[model samples]
Target: MLLAILLPFLSFMVRGKILTGIVCLILQITLIGWLPAAIWAVLSLNNARAERRNDKLIRAMKENGR
Candidate 1:
């Protein structure tokens, strides 16, 4: 998330998306895609956290079922 704030490109790179990160870096350098990149990073982080929470809930439910 910090990378999302400091370098939007690093966000994608940290996620193992080298190509996308490179592209984002180029776009960011252009000075026009910064806003979109920030928004995307926020949304991406939120979605990832939600998925992790849901996975934990599913695991708990299965454990309780047994």
Candidate 2:
């Protein structure tokens, strides 16, 4: 679910205490948090595509002496 995908990010984002980190990790295991997972997937995929496009453009520019 959403929490499952976001728990690690939250842990990194908050620099939280161990207890809160554990709670966030556990929250991901529940069925009620799927929307976050979907959002996370979309964002990650878009980032990947953007990186690929940038790389391709840079390579093309190099080849063309641009």
Q: lDDT by residue for model 2 over 1-66, one digit each (tens)?
A: 343254543632344345644554455456674455445544654665699999999999999994
Misplaced by over 4 Å in model 2 are: 1-29
Instruction: List TM-score per model, in order.
Output: 0.81, 0.53
The weakest ten consecutive residues by lDDT in model 2 span 8-17
Best by lDDT: 1
Candidate 1 clashes between residue pairs 3 or more apart in a chain or in different chains: none
Number of backbone clashes in candidate 2:
3
Candidate 1 lDDT over 1-66, as tens digits, reads 777877888998898878978887877876678878776766777888899999999999999999
Q: How far off is residue 37 in model 2, in Å?
A: 0.7
Give candidate 1 regions above 4 Å deviation: none
Error of 2 at 38 (Å): 0.5
